[model samples]
Target chain A: MNPVVLCTVARMMAPVLLLFSLVLTVRGHDSPGGGFVGGLLATAAFTLLLVAQPEELVRRRPRVDPTRLAITGLLVALGSGLPALFLGRPFLTGLWAQVPLPGGGALKLGTPQLFDAGVYLLVLGTAMAFILGLLHGEEEEAREREG
Target chain B: MTPPLLLTLPLLVCLGSAALAHLCPRRAWPRRGVALAAMLALTAVGLLLLVEVRRQGVLAVQLGEWAAPFGITLVADLLSALLVLIAGVMGLTVVLYSAATLAPELEAGAYYALVLVLVGGVCGGFLTGDLFNLFVWFEVMLGASFVLLALEAKQEQFEATLKYMTLSLVGSAVLLTAVGMLYGVAGTLNMADLATRLPGLERPGLVSTVAVLFLVAFSLKAGAFPLFFWLPASYHTPPVAVTTLFSALLTKVGVYALVRTFTLLFTQDVGLTHTVLLVMGGLTMVTGVLGAVAQYDVRRLLSFHIISQIGYLLAGLGLLTQEALAALIAFLVHYIFAKSALFLVSGATARASGTYDLQQMGNLYRSHPLLAALFFVPALSLAGVPPFSGFFAKLALIRAALRAEHWLIAGTAAGVGLLTLFSMMKIWREAFWKGHPQDPAAKQEAPSSVNVGWGVLGPCAALALVMGVLGLGARPLLELADAAAGQLLEPTGYIQAVLRRPP
Candidate 1:
């Protein structure tokens, strides 16, 4: 099969994996799974796409930088602390809210879950950065030659 | 602001700075400015902690009103808060140094980001009241450090980081598993609650096992004798600024956690903890100085000394007295600043000479007399020379140990101090006095003097001066350290502080 077709197939599966990861994360407080394992599953889905496609597709993208992923994760995590600060609670205090989903049912989201996702993205991005940076070394012509 | 909020504000600032830093353009100076501002804010928080600790006995902040045993808590006693203050000072110096010394292609933005997270994690570890929270903070610091270790991506860095990552991951896993087991048996993760509840529970074997597991994890992080190979290998690869920060702070955090836990929750097992600590302390001091004796590189020698100095802190904790604790705190504060200053000077030396290896670097006393003098005082201080902070710190520890009648350990530590002097003098002889043979190509390749920013040097010089002042102000600080240590050892104070009533 052509690599392009293989990649397209994996792209279609990414959302399903992501949804499952969220489910696992939501249930993690009482269950065996938490942000780390759930995040790994989501990262693996992205990794599958990179393997199927050319390196350039992943390397040249703007948001793929591992450092940025880490930064974003930290921002989300810190934002979780904001509610606590205003309410005079401790840092990383879990805040709660209920909102309506599109299907007329309530969805629960909390600061802990948001913090979980941030950790997920942070770890995934960090692991991916190391893997991708190594794989894409050939692309950094100017960087290597300078050294 | 409340004490917990005081700690949280710094993390929040770090988080914001991490974002603002990453958003800066690749060629921009804006990221450095933002990081500097964030660091200044953190220092302000540390100062606030000082004022709070002086006013109140110690401060506590519980999350979500769930109370201890159910919710996490953050505490800042004099000991932890003082360490936080030292950490903030070290961080600001390193950031200033980084702005000046960071080589091109080092990804300055990412470097600063990692530094911020590492700082936040260390402070978090210092403040958290729950055991599980402590484990989480340890992983946070280790994970950030792992990235920083491997970020430069050289051949040696790959091998070194892989070693560091594997060891750190295993240590963290061990730590988390121990947390799980402690939670299962004790049914609580809060440190104060554990202290009150633990001695009453009758399961000595399980407690001992969990304690041992924690010891191994912390020892691995502390780079104690048997577990120290990773420190020497990985520390020399990073830019000197990063190495300086890591050398000054990382393992010391491990030592702090060990001192905290053993003093608080595991005091019932004093015979076991004290004996093990004494033996490890003796071995670590000897082994570290031996490693230093064999090294020809300036940074590697300093790296070895870090492990040796940790042995001193362990010895103080093992002695387990008011005076010993005071000495440990004093020594650690002095060591953090002195060690970091020496490393920054090494960066300046490396820039001028094009190598950190002493074999390649000779006679620096002539051209760079100021830099030579800058490195000299810290080296002497580290060796425990009279009138320096190291001498006072050692004298206090020895006095405490003798008072406790641990003659063998005290004698061994003093002997190791002599070896410490020997290794430092070796560097002085080779790097500053003997001098390098001039090479035209190497001179052309030398890092620019602009890279050795006065902003960086000024902080380091101020830090060294501060260590001297700490010796002068030793009485009040010693009183505070004794109070902190008493709180940790007895832990009834901490338990009451958190339980909000008598147990």
Candidate 2:
């Protein structure tokens, strides 16, 4: 099932998909694209890699365990709410700031963006965990049949 | 000290511990330690929230400082506070029980993290003031429970989980549909706003239809009659600790939503809606008790009883009186403690006898007198025996039913009580009184006796003691329930607090 052309295409597409996911996440503040969709995109990128190179992906596990990644995302999301509490506002109150670029244009940032980032990581981790778990189950079944 | 802090602290502690537990994958003790600390902190915060709510009336905060009906609001009236407190205490007990009984394979599967997440979801469900937020909490709980149920799946476990998951997803779909319908009709998803707007809505028929959808969805979740087939099928499949946690919190969450929605938002058509509830309650009780009587498996029998007791809560809600709601709240508090204790005791008994079948178990009276006594207290309480918490709970509910002149339901409640006693006695005679089926003389020598550790017994005893205390000190809880009932009946204060507008 692993054709050379398909593998080559997947290798190229994976990086592009990941980069696009980040763009979607960052632009989600006032647009249609948000963390949830962006995270799914990132998961799709990983899925492409796994399909093209299953053994390599399995042997060299991702840098972050999927379960831990989801947990970290949850902490990040919850932590985003804490800053508002410290500022004496209600929990999850958006605190915004403007950062000026070298060219004099300013970038607007807020707690909601932090929350979107958290959602992005959470969605990616959770989807990958489900995919990997199913793949691992199939592999085990195949091994059992061979034995 | 702030309202938002009180509402969110339990969730933060739970998720924080979950994250911490996941950080160390290979180690068990560190995760256990984190869970234990988190549960202790949860219980302490729950108590503080209860106290603060009592002092300040209704405590509410709109997240992000958003205006009412626009942003998410968290509110802790007496009922929410009480439920949160019970959830915290039950979480603590279940975590302790799990520490002793959970298999190494399960522990390595991130079991503690899942449990903490489930508790956090339960707390969020109790505290949220928006309908959509409540749905979100339900999903959180459902997701965690699905994983927990199938964590180290065997063939039968997977089958049970499939049944559970499918039915729960259907319930969620129905719930979301109802939420959408309500929003379409009223143009808002905030519960406080809904309460004010529902009665005045021009489309009364549409409102009733949405209410029925809500009833069906919550009834499925609460394991009420005709829709409760999934409960007994799946509840007995999980590990005992998992079963204990589910029995303690999950169904009650459904009942809580039912009570909250009916009293607050659906009061416009009590004659039609409450009557259906009354009939459903009666049937649920009858079916549940009869089912319990027919079961020989201990967990399955208790699972049926959970359904029966939920009927009592529904009946109390059907009466639609302040006294009735108060009695229902009292019953809820008693039921959670008694039911959890019973499940823990059954788990211990199963451990000692190496079987869950009542027909296969015997001679615990002589072999483990302490465990026998521990089981007796909750069993009797569950059967509504006097000087135990369940007696007072049942008595109050019956009195409320009588005063409300719900003669048939009141009679059904009493009849169901007698049947419950019979089933509890069935368990007693089979598990504790009868001699061992294999070898009566060799029962003490059974190797499984060593497996029943203090970790299980300690929580059982503590819960039994709590039942006893609640029985002896029933007045305070009754008063608290009365206040909570008042708040539910007259949700004006809740609405005013959340919306900051005159109704």
Candidate 3:
């Protein structure tokens, strides 16, 4: 099962792919790239790791469960919409604040971006859950057969 | 609460409870408690909303500050608000029934969470003023119902799930395609806006085609005649808790949508569309009652009658008169209360006797006479026996049809009532009148049928009380229905209220 060349390449490519996914997530509201695309990119990187080290990767404790990440992300996104509701506008109406950046451009933030982030995490969590569940199921079936 | 909060609070509570339940799946206490508490709070909110709607005529809240025809809107006229109120009652009742009936493993898993989500979806469907939002809510409702239906992994359940799942998916697909085409035609998804735009379309034929598409999609969900095989096949396979919930609210939501769309957007083609409903409604009533007469299982029989009652609701809508629409509203509320009570009664019967098959059970009339009386109230009402809620409901429907000069439909409804009585009597004779068969296979170790817990009896008793009040005192409710129909018949009030436009 030893494939040093492919394993080494996967390890090298994973972190770079994650960085790219992060960039895609940050600029999502202002431009084409956003949470959903970035989440998929991150998922692709993790999927590569899953393929390369099926046992080692799963054996390690994930800091956050994929489902939990999705749930927390959804809560954050829903919370982002609460400001408008409290301010007597409407549910999920985007409220914005403009902050001048040190680099001379104004940075604007709003709730729609938060909603997109929720969508992104939801996609990521759902994909990972499906894959991990399948992988874990196969392992259990094999163990049962062996026993 | 503000209008927006009033609209969103029940949904938020439901989803928030579901999320909490999902997070703490192992801790049954918090999860179960949270769900029940959410339902209780929702019932209060629903009552308040109904009060507000009654006082204000129509309440509409545009979400995200986007005006009507532009952003999502949640509106609760009397029709929607009253349905929401009934659904809230059903939600609380189902939760109570499940608490006493469902297995510990199920309660500890995603069951209550999914149930909450399903409740949220149904409430959302009733409240949304946008057609696309209604479709989204239907998806949510179907997803949870599918899971709840198939949760039992037996062979019969496996088969039932496949049938239920396939047909439900097809319904959703039809709905989506129709929504897409409607948007293409009118360029708007808001219900009020669509009503204004649909009449202006150049191609009446194409509009009729889309009307037929919606007709098929909604009727499939409503379990109308010739397309309702899935109901009896799958409805009886679930636990009593799920059976009660599904038999009560799910099809009624479809009927609600059909009533809304036909009365609102598709009225331009009422000559064709309403006629389709009239014919289909008559067929559904006759077939559903006949189907019930053939069944030995109590729950399956009740499931068929679910179809029959939907026919009454649809027939009222098809008549397209002021009085007829009032009957639709009245019968809808009456059926929701009485039918759910009947389903819960069946659950108690099953709990006491350990089977859904009427042939296997016996002598409950002698042992638990009070329970038998409880069944008789709703069952007789369902059969339209005099002085009960069902009698008044069917009478109103028939009288409306007669007043509109729909003699054939009036005759069919009257005959369906007779057949409905026969089916109810069939259950009464088989399950109550006959003594237990001596064969070992026919009878289980008989529990003390008279010794019933409040947990199982309380919900049914509450529903029965409401039915009696509706029966003995139909005045207030009939007046309420009058106002509700007034709202539905004249959509201008609703449109202006929702869009905040000049009258």
Error of 2 at B454 (Å): 1.8
Q: Top lDDT: which candidate number?
A: 2
Lowest-scoring 10 consecutive residues by lDDT in candidate 1 chain B? B441-450
Every model's TM-score: 0.85, 0.94, 0.94
Lowest summed lDDT window (length 10), candidate 3 chain A? A138-147
lDDT of each: 0.79, 0.90, 0.85
Off by over 4 Å in 1: A1-70, A92-147, B107-109, B435-456, B501-503
Question: Candidate 2 lDDT, tens digit per residue, A1-147?
Answer: 556877899999999999999999999989889999999999999988888874865557645668668878878888889998876668888899999989889989889999999999889988988887787878645643453
Full ranking by TM-score = 3, 2, 1
lDDT of 3 by residue, B281-322 (tens): 999998898888889999889999999888888899889998
What's the CA RMSD of model 3 in angstroms?
3.0
Q: Model 3, stretches more than 4 Å misplaced? A: A1-3, A99-106, A138-147, B439-450, B501-503
Per residue, candidate 3 scores C-alpha lDDT tens digits across A3-78 of: 6776787899999999998888888877889888988998899888878875775567464567777777667667
DockQ each: 0.45, 0.64, 0.61
Candidate 3 DockQ category? medium
Q: Where is model 2 more than 4 Å wrong at Cα?
A: A1-14, A49-62, A100-105, A133-147, B442-451, B501-503
In candidate 1, the residue pairs with backbone N, CA or C atoms under 3 Å apart (3 or more residues apart, or in different chains) clash, namely B362-B435, B362-B436, B363-B434, B363-B435
Regarding DockQ, does 1 or 2 come out ahead?
2
Q: Which candidate is the best by DockQ?
A: 2
Task: Give model 3's share of reference contacts.
Answer: 0.54
